[model samples]
Target: MIRTVEVREARELLDHLLPLIASPWLYVVVFAIVAIDGFIPAMPSDPVVIGLAALSASGPPDVVMLAAVVITGGLAGDRVAYLLGRTAGHRVRNPKLVMAKQKAERALRRHGGGAILVGRFLPYGRTATAMTAGSAGLPPSRFTLHTTLAAVAWATYAIGLGRLGGETFARSPLLGAAFGIALGMVIGGAYTLVERRRAKTAAEEPEPELVASGRR
Candidate 1:
């Protein structure tokens, strides 16, 4: 009963909020959401980008501008997170986050420029990479170079999915947006699942044996 009420209320709130955010300010709204989400993993910026891009098929905020805004927002937000990590990295206490941070640090060390690029698709991945990079003392030039590439690729991927929905449902804006958001969620979920499976497989592999000290 409570879950149903909450869902209904959330829908009502979304319906109420949509019109309020549906104009020239739409760009600003999406940009802010994506940027803030860079540091704080609270909002679903991917769906917003996908939905807006799908609506762009109906011809309002130009697709180019929307794409630029999302990419720039992602870059800006991640850079800020990186900056914050420089000061706050040592303060992490939660066991899970600590493990994640250590893993990200190792990835940064092993892969150098593109570690974060590959991981950005996973949930909370941007934060993990940026923060770990900053805390790990990774050079700003290298981090920025790769993160820029990652942001552009991420934006393109999200917008592409939206465009797919828009093209498929040319006459129905709502349907296009709904389809795009759903598709992004499905793909992101699948990617995360695959990564987890891979991680498990790698963990289960046995390490090579070392020679005994007297054998030589």
Candidate 2:
């Protein structure tokens, strides 16, 4: 019941914001949402980007402008998360996160730029890759270059999905909204399942060091 209510409330909130996002200040709103959403993992910026693309279908702003806004918003949002990692990298010592630490460091060391480029396409990859890159002490210029390129590709893909919906439904905003929500739910659900599986596997695994040392 509570979960359903929260979903309903969230849907209502997104619906309420549609008109506001379509306003002349859309870019500013998107930029702010994207930036904050990255820092706070729960909030998603994809819906707003898709909304803007839908608005562009019947509206005044150019598609290019919408795309630019989405890209800028994403990059800005990622930077906030990246900066957080850069500053707080030392203090974060979670066993789960730490388990991935060596792999992340190895990725950067071996693959260098390509790993960061491809990692951006992943769900938690953007922030996680950025955080790992920071923790591994990758150069800022290299990190920014890869992140910027990845952001452009990601923004293009997201906005393109909305545009495809917009064009397919004869520029109908309703269709775009539907597509965005559906995609968000699917991706969100998949992410949840992956996390649960990872947790389960981690819980089931024996501690190699403890086993070897006969401590358990």
Q: Considering every candidate listed, which one attains the maximal TM-score? A: 1
Task: Score residue 205 of candidate 2 by CA lDDT.
Answer: 51
Query: What number of clashing residue pairs does each candidate have, in the order they appear?
Result: 0, 0
Residue 86 lDDT in candidate 2 = 78
RMSD of 1: 7.1
My TM-score estimates for the predictions, one after another, are 0.82, 0.70
RMSD to true structure for each model, in Å: 7.1, 7.6
Worst 10 residues of 1 by lDDT: 1-10
Q: Model 2, residue 199: displacement in angstroms?
A: 14
Off by over 4 Å in 1: 1-17, 20-22, 93-99, 204-216
lDDT of 2 by residue, 117-197 (tens): 655544445556667676556667777787789778877766776676666665567676556546655665776578658
Please, what are the lDDT tens digits per residue for candidate 1 over residues 97-210?
A: 567666676566556658778756766677778888777677788778888998999899888888889888989976887787777767766776787787787676654322
Cα miss at 31, model 1 (Å)? Answer: 1.2
Candidate 2: C-alpha lDDT: 0.60
